[model samples]
Target: MNALSIDIEVNEAHLRQQFEDCSDIVFRSFKLSDGAMLLLVYLDGLTHVQSVEDNILRPLLFNGLPQGEKPVPSLAERMKREWLPLANVQTVDSSDALVQHILRGSLGLLVNGEAAALIAQIPGFEERSIQEPKKEATLRGSKEGFVENLRTNTSLLRRRIIHEDLKMESFTIGSYTQTEVVLAYVKGLADENVLSEVRKKLGQIDMKGIIDSAYLEEWLEGSSYSIFSQIQNTERPDIVAASLLEGKVTLIANGSPFALILPITFWSGLQSADDYFERFVFVILTRAVRYAMTFISFALPAIYVALSTFHPEMVPANLMISIATARENSPFPTVIEVFIMMFIFDALQEAGVHLPNQLGPVGSIIGALVIGQAAVEAGIISTPIIIVISLTGIAAFTIPRYSATMPFRLTRYMILFITGFLGFVGFAYGIIFLLIHLVMLESFGTPFFRPVAPFDGRRIKDIFIRYPFWIKNGRNKKGGQQ
Candidate 1:
């Protein structure tokens, strides 16, 4: 039952029973001029019908075997070597393998009096065309983005990093889906330990299916409880090629357009795709602005709450008087007002994301302006709090990665609550704890706050400022080997 039988009827019956009730499974049988009965099995939409008809059916039915040729031991072997016009053809001995091949858009040919089956690769599935990345756009760089097709994505990487050392290892992770996942890296350049760890983690995944690269990210991350993403994902193949050159590993799944990059650092989130494409002088200024805005986003509201409520003397006399005058008519405390405004801001943002593209931006902007003005005019919220919340929202938008912004958003609320209660002391302690947590985190054994927490003076330059390519001599020292 496991292996194909020499009798065509036995093999046909076994395969039919295996694929019973499968409406899309095609079973086409025909006899050769020499009277050798052949059966072709494949999925309906997945297999290329034209290629099968022209190259397989037409050749086998009309051409037959070579005239006066000696009898070969296996009919499948002869067809694969001379009869078939296809390039990718292989033999499978077991019925299980034959079924798997057929499912994966391959044509399975079983001949009379032969135990072996020939599998022809001719996959034809609809997929999105490669377009510019929607999220990680840059002013200047390659515009091509990744599509859902696995082979097409790999080809994109190969086109960029054309070297023999660029190696890819394939894995089938999903139990039912049997989705393909590829791990790519530069040989000898990537750290052996990191590679081993990636392999071990991937093998341990017990999921029923992996629909996207994000699924692998959860399994690959060393710290599952942490909010910070250990693995970076992007739709741009250029970014993937850049990561591979730096001695990092990438995971590209079959159905997902996003590719996962590993051993990422805190700096990775702050860095943008435009950083490398633009001039270093411009990049340095942009990066500085981003870092500054990142801090403002995380601590602006907390600092305001701490000073206004608990440390009034620390604030200037004029600002304190102005804050008090603005808040005179508000019913809630400063902390409570901030919490309410923050909640509304977050809800509006979520609404924007879920809404259609035509209305998302317009609705969020109009909603925020209208809601904030209405609250302030109605004396429900103070004017100063509105300004602070608006500034904080803008600052948070400066961070390039959407994933990176989430942790800051969540922690901002926590710090705001703590600062409201304990003032400056609480704000300081919150920052210290966040830094400690970041230092403790790792991505596939690479320190999360690399070159900063450990204080690598040499590598620190790339974090605070973009170094020109001329001065760089070797691969990235953070996670890759020299």
Candidate 2:
């Protein structure tokens, strides 16, 4: 039967059977001063042993109930009202719920004749201390980042936005893991439609396990096939608080250090945490340079290949001569040279990422210099091709978000191949196709390329330039505050 029995022996037997072979489960049985049987169930390392000893056990075994007081109708109520010295306490009537509570690091107490159990909140498992964000570091903003503990992460957000409007709804995902996922948003600021969509998508997830925030990210995205990430992720609590103020929804999963933000725009990927903290004039200039670098990183290789192969006349005479002379000794065409170097460059980058931290940067830098010089000396690749690929790699690092840079980096090769075959026509077609795809994309019902494709003049300024906080007024139509 799912319901707890009035007999304590039956309940203890069922609980022990449910936790069969689990070495970590702790069961403490003793007799109260009134000669009544009592049982305590908790996880060994998860529940706070010191609190249980001082609060529940000491008061019950030594102090007993108050003298000359009328007896309560039920033992569970008596303990809850006058005996237990814990802050949070609740009662569960079913075996399943009692087991669930015990598994979540709570202490469960069973009385001899009662059909209910008292659960005390005493989670004390070890967790990492809060540290500065490693991925999105900012010089001026707060250095604190989210941690794996769900309550700790929520507390971080609470410390930033101290308002009653900030609401956090909880959900339990993963049948096996039973991981906790929290959805955070402001009451009046967040759009009801977007919030509904997020809830619907989350309900549709039927996964067996959710190990990290990325697992939810994959399921919550509008399109699975799109290269661009529809939801933005950050480790900083300030970013999450800012997104909530702008009427966006955020998801924080248990055992994950990153939090996911939804209904993001194309321009959001180009923006950085430092932009909001810096002066508006300086930020505008930095953003302009970043945009230019993004373009060069994506299209530079294709443009060079098309001009050298089919539109050589468009190039300057002196540069054209130099390129031709460099490729004279190379056996393969310009396209092959570019492709080979690109593959090697990508391999080196991957190796660097997987290596130990101390060796990663050193290995990538030394490997690139040695490989490039060797390939050029052997005449397998032209000097000009190496320079072009190097410039493209350097320019790619300028993009603020790593997820945003991936699409451009991957698509660059496809455009290079097409341009090599069909010349300038292929380059133009590729650019047009990319723009159309972006315009058609959506993030939880909000346009992915908003303000630019739809031509919103008021919000466009925030894309290319950052206006002073005093000058900006009201919220954008979508999920951003102007």
The Cα error of candidate 1 at residue 305, in Å, is: 0.6
- Alpha-carbon RMSD of each model: 3.1, 3.0
Question: Taking the tens digit of each residue's C-alpha lDDT, what string does model 2 give over 315-382?
Answer: 99999999999999999988888899989988998999899999999999999999999999999999
Off by over 4 Å in 2: 65-68, 82-85, 474-482
Residue lDDT tens for model 1, 1-482: 39888999999999999999999999999988889898999999999898889877887778885443666677656765674566588898899999988998888988888889988888876779999998888889999999999999999999999899999999999888899999999998899999999899888999899988889988888888997888998999999999999899999999999999988998899899899999999988899899999999989999999989998999889989999999999999999999999999999989999999999999999999999999999999999999999999999999998888999999999999889889999999999999999999988888899999788987887888888765554456564534
The C-alpha TM-scores of every prediction are 0.95, 0.95
Q: Clashes in each model (backbone N, CA, C under 3 Å)?
A: 0, 0
What is the Cα root-mean-square deviation between model 2 and the actual structure? 3.0
> Candidate 2: global Cα-lDDT?
0.90
Clashing pairs in 1: none
**Which ten contiguous residues of candidate 1 have the minimum total lDDT?**
473-482
